[model samples]
Target: MDVSQRLSFFAALFKVHENPTTGMWLLYITIVLLSILVFKLGFAKKLPIIKSAVIYTFLILGCTVLTFLGVFLPVAEGLVVAALILIIYKIRLHQEKKEQAKAE
Candidate 1:
């Protein structure tokens, strides 16, 4: 192949993925991490897990409602929301134990 053709072939091989689904999934994960960071920084005095969970759930639910209003796909929104809920639940459980310890 000519140099132009060879260069084009290599360029195609290095091209970024254009899959909207995959990109959306990645965006969801990034948002989750950002939410976690926000909770960590904002509620450092609280139980780590509890703060994380509350922030995560709130953000996820907000995102889900937005998606329902035709912002994104249901599947993507569901997965992200589920993740957020799970994180919040874990944190809440941990906080309960810590509070009990304080009481005792």
Candidate 2:
């Protein structure tokens, strides 16, 4: 099969067209959460503007590509879930560090 055919095949495989509304919402939520996370992380490191710019540029590029491929929503949902997990892990680590510091 040709490129278009291959792409469609994969998009169908991922069920991108199954629920457009849900997918759009997922993409929206993913973008919002990612922006917040990036901003917070960047500011925490004292490079808010530069860091958020760099990270968001890549993220938007990736999202655009996925949108074109018709799998943007599913991918965005996965990313959001992963980011939340990472945030939770980071918070736990920070708490543990604080406890250790207090004990010492």
* Candidate of highest TM-score: 2
By lDDT, who's the top model here? Answer: 2
- lDDT of the structure predicted as candidate 1: 0.51
- Report the lDDT tens digits of candidate 1 across residue range 14-33: 22134545544555454455
Q: What TM-score do all the candidates reach, one by one?
A: 0.35, 0.50
Per-residue accuracy of model 2 over 25-104 as CA lDDT, tens digit each? 55544555664575454344555788758866776666555555444225444445667777887899999999999999
Off by over 4 Å in 2: 1-55, 70-73
Shift of residue 25 alpha carbon in model 2, Å: 8.8
